[model samples]
Target: MLPVFTTPPPLGSGDEIAVVAPSRPIEESKLQRACDRLRETFSLDPVIFETATKDWEWLRDNPEARAEDIMRAFEDPAVRGVVAVTGGDDQLRVLKHLDPDRLTSSPTRFYGFSDNDNLRLFLWKHGIVSYGAVLHPTVTVDPELHPYTERYLRRAFFEESLGVVEPSPEWADEWFDFETGDPREWRENDGRTWRGEETVTGRVWGGCFSIVKWHLQTERYLPDPGDLDGAVLALETSEDVPLPREVRYTLRAMGERGLLGRFSGVVVGRPQTHSPGLEWNPGDDYREQLRDEICAALDEYNPDATAVFDVEFGHCSPIAPLPLGAKVTLDPTVRRIRFQ
Candidate 1:
């Protein structure tokens, strides 16, 4: 098993949460809107760090600047938590510049995902349970943020524990870019699907499969295989959706490394099966296809491990901010996921 990780205190009214862009730059307009909502809804303070507003080219060139902004947020006594404005491609570069001591010294709350998972995994390695990027998509959403997502954001931000995770009323099948344009195609939610029997309780590990695969290949960011024993494996696909073959290969590698059998359960987030310009959906054909590969992998490597799919997280519109390394009970029989 891995070392014990600290779960940061929840945010409260007047608490200051720092917004930083460690992976990519966020639009100033969107940041302003999110901050306004944070103040109005929760009566909390939202502070913007340097990288969140910096030009894209500059942030890309100086990975150290990104690291500095993250460490700055962590080290600040006034800051209660840190958030990634959005996600991008090259966050692996920023990881090298980070000093674990500076971050862990303060032990403040953190929330981010997608490419931001790189940093989340880093903090996880150092024994700090980091959160999902609730403020990322919640920042610039049009009309208003989805109620499903909003509810989880509230729980993650203000509550000590996110009690029971329920299925969203609706699911987003299509969407626009973060900068905003057009409405998201909302479809009726079908809820979660479970495979394997028995309730499994453990700390959740893993994030966007592509990023996890990257860590697997490098072998630098991942913990020792045996260290994940009895942990629940959290898996999901990003907007840049990978085909089933890719999923097969990655899981095969995990199985070969003796990593697949370590998990007592698996929580697979909803995949972005349909993205603008890369439309490849013929009524859940691709979704089922991707799911099949994942099941195949689990069957081969971890036949007894319980896994639930399409649980509204990761790239999906309605997301639950699963705290990496935090204890959770995944009860397949009751269809309830409770976080502590």
Candidate 2:
């Protein structure tokens, strides 16, 4: 097993946080609102890069520029944390330009999800901790940040462990229209319930499924048995909402790479709401097929490890913040996930 490492302390009040756009560009207005909310609500001073608000013409206008912003954020001692504006599909193109030494030496709170999975695992491989959770635009635009999201963000970025993560009292649907600026209505759906009351604690790792699968093809964040040993594997799919066979193939590939059996447990997020082109109805059996594929993969690979499902951590509303590389304990009996 790769030796475990410690993360730096959370950003206290009055610390500076840098906001950057590492992948696709974003809408300037929404980005500014996100920054403004952070300052007004949390008293955090933010530093934003130029490209963060500008939508690059391509995957990224310049991968080197993205790398520079990240490096600068890490190198700046005043910057206590870093948050991505949003995530996009192609971040692997920028991996080669990053300076791992800077990321390793200055450990800041790195927050993002979806395609940011590419960067999160990169940080993890270098012994730095990053977070897999809501980013600025997604969480900031909420009429009010979801209580669970705010609660966990506070714990992950400021305070210590507040307590366990329970299923969101209310959840959201696939129809949230970002352009309208209205808070998305909460929609609860049925799925698997927490199985048992046993808390399985271990190091936390893993990220978005499609992105992780993409990373596997490159050296930037390929899974290593040594790095994954004893870590808790966490995953969620993206908006693409891949089919069951695709999901199975991806997990099966991980198993082939010897990554499936190395973790202490598995935490799977709820499947995303709007999958492109697949107009699956609310009560369709697509999710059931997904569950079956996942179970098959797990049983084929690591049947002994503890596993749980129906976690509200994906391209869903009212998401929970998860600190990557931190310690997480899953209690199926009580339906709680505690990060310590």
Candidate 3:
């Protein structure tokens, strides 16, 4: 059995939430709007750092500074949670500078996805609970944010148990054209449907597959021998929408490392359809290929593992906010996910 760790304390309406650029540099204007939305819509204070809006030499150019911001958030008695403005390509660079001892003791509610997977997995290893979910502008800042997205974030941060993880009726990969300063584009989004039935329950973990593969190669965010046993592993590809083979290869590596068998169940997020160079058909064929590849890998490691694919979460609209270390009860009987 995995040694369950501590769950971070919840946030209150008037409490402050820290915003930091742990991975990539977000546009100043975009960051401002996201902060504004958080305050106006959510009614929570959005605290930002000096470099929160700047793009310097690298996304994580100032590793020490980035680490400092995280430590500060965890140490601050007033700050209820910490959120990453956006995800960049290389966040593993910031891992070495982090004070794990400080994080292990603090257990602040942290949120981010994509490359932020580096930080999420790091927190998991140190016995601190973190969130693997959408960020500010990615899922929040828009003409109108997804109702369920806002609700999930609110409950994940402030409420005791994230009551029920429901299938988002609507989902999307559309980016709110923030260059216009107008929030009119927010309503554009794809919708979600309930996929295969039969929910399974376990602790939640995992994130962007690319980032997790990167961390595994670097041996940075590995869980202790028994830290992840019986956990419900959740994963999603980034905007890149990697080929089915690439996904299989990554999972194959996990099996080779003996990590794939640690999970009691698995939750696969619906892949994003749009990308810069590649275009994938949002059809049943593509979905079938994806399912075949992922299942092939899992079957090789743990054939009896409970798996659910195409869950409405990840780098998209109407995404689900998952607490990295939270216990998740996936009841397929009702197609529900309850976090306790």
Could you say which candidate leads in TM-score? 1
TM per candidate comes to 0.95, 0.91, 0.89
Q: Which is better, 1 or 2, measured by TM-score? A: 1
Q: What's the distance in Å from true for residue 17, model 3?
A: 1.0
Q: Poorest 10 consecutive residues of model 3 by lDDT?
A: 185-194
* Clashing pairs in model 1, backbone N/Cα/C closer than 3 A: none
For model 2, residues 1-340, the per-residue Cα lDDT tens digits are: 4545657668888789888888876677667777776787677888886657566774365888888888888889899988888888778877888988887777777878887777888787777777765355455656776677777677767865535777777766555456776877676656445433446787777778877777776654664667777778887777777777788888898888788888778888877655547665424665677777887887888776677776767576667766677788887666667877
Task: Using TM-score, rank the candidates from best to worst.
Answer: 1, 2, 3
Q: Tell me the TM-score of model 3.
A: 0.89
Model 1: how far residue 193 lies from native, Å: 0.6
Candidate 1 ranges with C-alpha deviation above 4 Å? 176-183, 279-283
Tell me which residue pairs clash in candidate 2.
196-332, 196-333, 197-333, 198-333
- The backbone clash count of each candidate, in order, is 0, 4, 9
Off by over 4 Å in 2: 1-3, 134-136, 161-163, 189-199, 275-283
Candidate 1 vs. truth: CA RMSD? 1.8
- Candidate 3, residues 1-340, lDDT tens digits: the string is 3444777888888789888888777667667778777788778898886557557574445887888788888888888898998887888888888988788767788888888878888887766677765355554456677688878877877777677777776555555665664643233223323333445567777888888778777874677647777878888877787788888998898888788888878888877666666666545355567778888997798676777777766775667676777788766566566788
lDDT of 3 at 199: 57
* Residue 227 lDDT, candidate 3, scale 0-100: 70
